[model samples]
Structure formats: structure tokens, C-alpha cells
Target: MKGRFSHGGGAGALARGRLARYGADMTQSLPAFAQNARFDVCALGNAIVDVLAPCEPAFLEAKGLVPGSMQLVDETQSATLYDAMAAGVEASGGSAGNTVAGVGSFGGRAAYIGKVAKDTLGEVFSHDIRAVGVHFDTPVLEDGAGNGFGTGRCLINVTPDGQRTMCTFLGAANQLTTADVDAGVIGDSAIVYLEGYLFDPAPARAAFEAAAAAAHAAGRKVAITLSDSFVVHRWRAELLAFIESSADIVLANEGELHALFETEDFDHAAAHLGRIVEVAAVTRGAAGSVLFRGGERVEVAAYPVEKVVDTTGAGDQYAAGVLLGLSRGLSLAQAGALGSLAASEVIAHWGPRPMVGLKSLAVQHGLSL
Candidate 1:
């Protein structure tokens, strides 16, 4: 909420012009609930630990793995892949978890809700997220409980080109239920973010609904991210229905957006999205992103990156920036810029989380926190 920047031309002007063309009320701004909320953003997602290792394209081929796809595996399969992988780094990561952590890195009051097992990886996940300053107190699933599931973990194989292919075991993360949705946390946050990856489970889906209802009842906003193209493909109709009924904001990458609408045309998908959600932000990798609100359209360019070390968590970090910006009353164009800045920083590293202080990096990039 401090060091805000002035709106400039180009995308900003285009957005305004588009609003005028549609006769939409340009004076309507994002809700002011953030001003009084105890937390800026509370995110719900799969609680996962990521094991990242650099590999060659041949490694993926030998493993019968697609170069850049995420496939779900069982505990035995996950263990097999981990053993075959080279020395790797382990870190706490999940779509919404990374986003909330990024929010905290930008000096926002962030919180997270997810189910992890009472295991070593779960302990690591809890300690790491809290260490980053995000409020995360969701109870750990009791050992021997949760239908015999343990802590969830992801095995990520990053090729030389920085593309990441993942094998995930949901495990205890899939045990998240409506009981885990804290109405108090949902009501206290300015925005509640739900991760699409959690949509596959019945209980987690119910939890999402409960959280959305609590947020709306408390006059808070709800944001949902189409986590991946695979996720969109898996729950297209259900996701569309949820967005229409509960979400105020939608975030996605070009692939996910295209999959959601079953289209190859970006503009067509974006236009349809504008009509459904109050706000939409779609990322197009190095080409940057486009933001839509009502009938207005804003195209923000990608921030420059020196090198792309690993492409993991680019979209999650991008969500972190845009969500934080919106909570602080920034315009759509400004929010997109923050998203681009955060994304550029993450892709230049080896992990999903930012290696540098995002708040300081934002200031250096001329973006006021």
C-alpha cells in the first residue's frame, strides 16, 4: 500500500479507451476491503515439497516423460523417480504456497491453508513457509490417518532449456477437506486465492467452495488460478462453473486459457473470460501478459531476464505480484507490470521461490511496493 506508481500511457491508455468504448463505468475500482483486513492474501493449495534436479532431454526420453508436462504418480513411482534423479535441491512448493510466499516477499500480509502429513517433508514445508513470513497453521494430517497417505512431494526434472517436467504424488495433500477451510482466515483476508491443482479431489473442491463463500460473505474478493493446462483440461466444465459462481478474479497462462475455452485463438479466449470474471490476467511467457476487466484490455510486456535457469513457478510468482498489487489498489496495467517483474526474477533462478527480496527488486525496477 506504499510507494505506489502513477499510471502511464500505452497499455494504461488502451485500457481506459476500451472501457470507454464499451460504455463500462471506469470509475468502479477494486474493493477497499484490503485497507482494513488483517491479511492481504490467504491461499489454499496442495502442500508439497519439490525435489528439483537438472537433466538432459534424453533423460526425459529414457524415462518416458514428456519434456514439459506434469503427471501424477503413486508413492512407489515417486520414489523410483527420485532415486533415478541426480543430486537435487528440496524446497517447499505448491502453486498457491509459492504465491503466498511471494506476497510475503513483497511485504504483504500473507497466509496459507493446506494439508500436509505429520512427516519430515511436512515439517520442512511448515518451517519453510513460516520462515518466509507467511501465516500457515493448518493442522498436519495425523500419521497412519488420511487414508494411508503421507506427505505429498513433486519430482521436477529441469532440462537445459529451463523447461520443467514434473511427477507429483498428492498423498496427504489430497486429504484437504472443508474442515480445513477456516472461515475466520477467509473473512480476515482481503483476497482468498484457490489453486486449481487442488480441484481434482472432492474434499478440496468443497473446501474451495466454503472458502469462497466465507470470503464473499465478509466482503472480501476471491481469486482462482488455472494452475496448468493439464488441470484445465481435467476439469474444464467444473472450473468454468466455479468461476462464474464464485471467483472475482481469474489468472492463467496462455495454454491454460486456450485449454479452458478449447481454442487456439488468444483474443477469443480472453474476450470470453472478460465477460465472465470481474478481472482476468493471462501470461504468455516471454511475450508478456494481457489483463482484462469488464470490456477493457491492457497488454503489459514481459520484464527482461538475463537468463532462464529454470522455468518452475513463473506463473505462481506472477500471481503473487498481481494479487498483491490489486490488494493495494493498483490499476490492472500496474498489476500486470508487477506480475511481469516477479516472473522475470523467478525464471532466472533454480527454484520456484524467489532468490532475492522481491520488495527490493520491485523498487529497483521502479515499481513501488
Candidate 2:
């Protein structure tokens, strides 16, 4: 805890000295290490390429996109909209992709499993994922583009308020079959993570089920995140079934958890969910996060951020921090605190990916990532 703030939440003079030594411009500028540190975790989710563009509210209405929500679009619709948009930043994306990426940022060893076409976007996705130090070994589709279906892409529109509206075109991501679930990958890692969004597609569902079975048989753990509210509304019964059957650790934000339990009150939904899953963590933005496990409860305060740019990958990165902490043998409360810390860093920026070096950033805060 050297050079960090005191127990009262105020930084000490030692912290100031360390901050000065690191660099006055930004503590995040510190480089990340621990690429082959032999992590205690790994994950599997949809591998997607993100196409982010600056957008006006009018553009959303003209394109019939619901502002502040994720809408699944068909290949034709995705192409039509994409063709009309301006240039964008193509980054590696997906629910679990963000989580695993955040894990890598914090110097945790992680791997990802998903599908993409053997095209430019796919190459970008693979490169970005690997550059972050997450092992990815899925086979890319070679014949997708000839049939008019391009690679899996997400059209992300960032508004003036820093809110993001997402439109997803599954494409090759939907083609993630059971064969893509490598038993060795499942066995080698300490945990396997799945995204609730992948449950909507039949092929992805089969792949997830196979992966879960492999992880369980190998004596590894299984984790799941309820990706969005609509996904829960559309597949509530199935998600409930998944909680009972496969999920060992479940992560959800306040809104998504309420919708999943069909309740209006957060306390009501959280109480109900706590009884069903082995471990449940619900994130309340600004209000912080809560954990329920073994009839015990823990509440972790939200780490303060100077600014909230884009709320795109806050929850995903939060899960990454929590999982990384757990892999490092930290207590649940410690894990949740790390999750809050990582999430605070992302909200201070514009992209889903973390711009800060999470490793030394944690060390500055007297934390070990």
C-alpha cells in the first residue's frame, strides 16, 4: 500500500511523490507488463469488430435506430446503414471481449473464443485481441464474403453526451459452431466466461453449451454476464434456466438484473437472483456494486472518475477487473473493488478499450493487478 492514499480515501504525500515520479501528465501512461505471467483465468464470447463513428441524434432517427439501445440487424440492413456512414475506428469488441481485454490490461492471463471471417475486419479483431495479450485460436471463415455476408461488425454511434447506440450485425459471429469450443482451452484455464447476448443465436447457444460442459467436466468454473436489458426480456426463461444449470458466477448491471427477474425494485430482483445462482454480482452505476454469495452480502463503493465520456464498456471492464482479482486469489470484496477501479478508468475515456495502463495504475492506487 506504499505511495497510495490513506484509509480515509485521501492520497498521502507519499502518493504525491509517486505520482510525480510516474509522470505528471497521466498515471495511466505507465506501460503494462505480465504478458506471460501464467494467469488464473480465461474466457469465451462473441468476437466482434467495432466500427465507431461520431454521430448526431438526427442520424439515429433517420436510420431508425433506437438511441441508447442495442438493436440486432440483418445483413442487408447492416450493410445498408454501414455503407452510408463515414469512416470509423475498427477495434476488437464483444461483451466478453471487453472483459478479457480488461483482464489483459490488468496483467492477467486470459484467452477468448469466438468466430470471425478471414477478412480485414477479422484480422483487425485478431490483432487487437492478441496485442492485448489474450490468446485467441478460433478459425476464421474463408467463404463468407462471396455470399454477400461480410465479417461480424458492430456499428457504434457515439453522441455528444458520450452515450453510445449500438447496431450489431452477427454475420460470421453467428456462425460460431460447436466445433469452435476447444476442450483443451476450456480445461487449461481456471474459468470460462460466456455472454448472454450469444444465447440469442442457435449456433452460438450450442457452442456455449458445449464450452460450459467442457469447463465443468474439466473441473473449471463457468461465468456469465447478462449483456443487456432487452436480451433478458427476450430470453428471460432461458436465462433463468441457465442460471440454474450452467452459470457459477453471474454479473449484471442494475437495469438488466431487474428486467431479468421481471421486478420493478432493485432489492426485490437482487434478493431473488441471489438465491438462484452460486454467486451474483449486480453493478449499480455511481452507486457502486453489490455481491451475493453463500448467504453473505458485500457492497463495494464506486471508484471516483473525473469524467464520464462513453458508458460503452464500463460493465465489461468491471467484470474483467473482478475476474482478474479472483484469479489472483483476492477476496470477493477485493475483487469487486478492483472491478470498480478498472470501470472508473474506462468511463474517463471514449472507447470500450482501456486507454490507461491498468497494471501500474493499480500499483499507484496501492493495488496489485
Candidate 3:
């Protein structure tokens, strides 16, 4: 089995070996060596359970779900919607959850911070994330409303065009506070990654801000994801100021970038964006990714995929690959290439997370992972 995964014995060897023997069955567990090892990156964000269902584009119009945006719904509305929706896959997910999962998949040392409830969905969330080898330590609420006193769920409806529309019910997820962020954990990692989605809620936003402060105090870098275009539209001024003052690395897709800068032309957006964050990554779907830093532009082409299934966590996973590469001292160009490759693989599957042996896939694609 080692022979099957011993190509370079690099960052992803353990993940590769496990996947080579288990394939998609997920029975072969990643070794404890993978989790206990010191990390290059750690993430703090909402801990959410995802309820995913395939739906038509018309469903978006009918439900008034602005396609591709993650909307926050009240408890009553969330329950009503859940009861009305068809049966779907319940997966552990969140903006940063997906990113950390991707990091673990690629055999990187990754830990996550968020909150959930002590219920069925919380157990599922814990199992799924830990199974992929991410270190997650967050207290779950024992008695709460909605979803059996567990964490909130992000209802994801994937349209035929591979677009994912998300509706989030905060539940216990918003319970994450500044106290939940471990200063030791932030200091231990080479970089601390935060998801902008946390900003929508006050406690989670404070937690994110505190994490960033702690990471900088510890002389570690900070990375952030814009999360969604609509979220940017809602928090534009604040986000811009935050990016300028705090974020070392920032990620956003084309739509979110344009929305963030409130510009029609991407060129204008990119130029302005380059001035704010130390490094800015703009994903262009099939066209690839564009990276800007210190007035230099690097374009990484997308990996060719024969099939497209779901676009749920493409950006999150891509960011994972990029952060892992950057943390390991890879060049920006190489990092973006690795990001694009991982994203292509996820889109070829049905879920927001990877179903394939990502470590081996990265090795096959020439990444050290």
C-alpha cells in the first residue's frame, strides 16, 4: 500500500495511501500522525450541517433564493422550509469547514473552530470532519431549538447548471464567541484562515476579529474568504475596511470580487482589490484563477474536468489547496494551480467536499501534496 502511495513521500502520502486502499468507500481511516502533527494552517469559522438537494433553476425563482447567495433565515422559516423540502444528504459543512476538510484531504495538518449542538447533526458533523482528519474542538449546545438541539444547517440546493444556492439557519453556529477561539491554536499554525460568513453574526464576527488579532500577535499570517457575493453586498464598507487593515490573503470568485468592489468591470475591481489585501485570489470558474500581489498578476489555468456535478464547495476547497500550498512555501503560481486542480475534482462529484483520493490526485497532477 505504501508502494502505491510512496511517490515522493511528501505532504499527502498518508491521505494517498488511505485512499488508494479504500477508494471512495471511506473505510480506511487517516492515521493519527496526520492529525497530531503540527499544522501549517488552521481555520476558524461557523460549524454547520449542510442539507443538500438537487433542484431546478426554477426552484430558485419560486423560493426567491437569489442564486448562489447564502441567506440567513429565522428559526421558524428554516423549520418550515426544511419540512417542505425533499429528502437530501446531510453533510458536515460550513465555509471554513469545507476549506479545512479540503486541507485534511490533501494530508495537511488542519484544525477547525466553530460551534454546534449536541445532537444527531452535530454528531454527524463531528464524525465527517474528524474522519477526514481535521481537528475540530467546539462545544455543542445540549438543549436548543430546531434540529434536535444541534447546530444550524445550511440548506444547499444545487441547480442543474452546478450553481449552489444556500439558506443558513444560524442555530448554535452563531454561538461561537471570542472565547471559543484558542490563542494557542492560532499561534501554532503558520496561518489562520477566517471565513467572512462569520461576520454576518455579531458573536461569530467578534470571534473572527479576535482570531485575526491573535494570529497577528503571534506573528502568523491571516487569510480570509469573501464567502459570497451577496454577503459582500450586505457588508461592503465594513469588509473593505477589514481587508485593508487585517487580512493578509483574501479570496473571492469573479462575482464576489465584482460585488465587493461594486464595479461592473473586473479589471477595475482587480486593480482596486490588489491595493487592499496583500494577496488577492480571484477564481474565474472554468477560465481559471488570477492572483495579484505587490502589483504582479499570476494566472493559473483551471484543471480540465470531463464532468460537472456540484459547485457547492468549489471555492472553499480551492482556497484549502491554495492555503496548504502557500503554508508549505510553494510559490503563488503553484499554489493557485493546486487550488484549481482540487476545485476541478470536487465539481466533478456530487457533494461540496471531495469524494476522491485528493492527495493522490494532487500527486498525479504534480503537486507535492
TM-score of each: 0.91, 0.87, 0.88
- The local lDDT score (0 to 100) that residue 7 gets in candidate 3 is 11
Measured with C-alpha atoms, the lDDT of residue 295 in candidate 2 is 71
lDDT value, residue 209 of candidate 1: 86
lDDT of 1 by residue, 1-369 (tens): 112222223344334432111112422343466646788899999999999999999999999998888888998899899999999899999989999999999888899999999988889999999999999989899872346688899999999989999999999999999999989989999899999998888899999989998898888889999988898999999999999888889999999999999999999999999888888999999999999876679889998888899999999999999998778667787778878888999999899999999988877766765
Winner on TM-score between 2 and 3 is 3
lDDT of 1 at 29: 42
Per-model tally of clashing residue pairs: 0, 0, 1
lDDT of 3 by residue, 1-369 (tens): 000000112224332422122122421232221122266678988888888888888877988888877898977778887886777788888989999899888887798998888777778888999999988887667675455335788888888788888899878888888888888888777678999899898888999989988877776778899988888998999888888888888999998998887788998998888876767899999899998866668788898888788888899889988887666545567678779878998899777788886787877865654
Tens digit of per-residue lDDT, candidate 2, span 1-369: 001101111123223422122223432322121112234466777778888787889999998888888889988888888888777677788879989899889877788898888888888889999999989989888887666546788888888777788999988888898999888877777667889889889989988888888877766667889998989999999988877887777899998998898888988889888887656789999999998766767788898977787778889999988776544444567677778888999888767889987877778786653
**How high a TM-score does candidate 1 get?**
0.91
Candidate 3: where is the Cα deviation over 4 Å? 1-37, 145-149
Model 2 scores a C-alpha lDDT of 0.77
Query: Model 3 residue 326 lDDT?
Result: 62
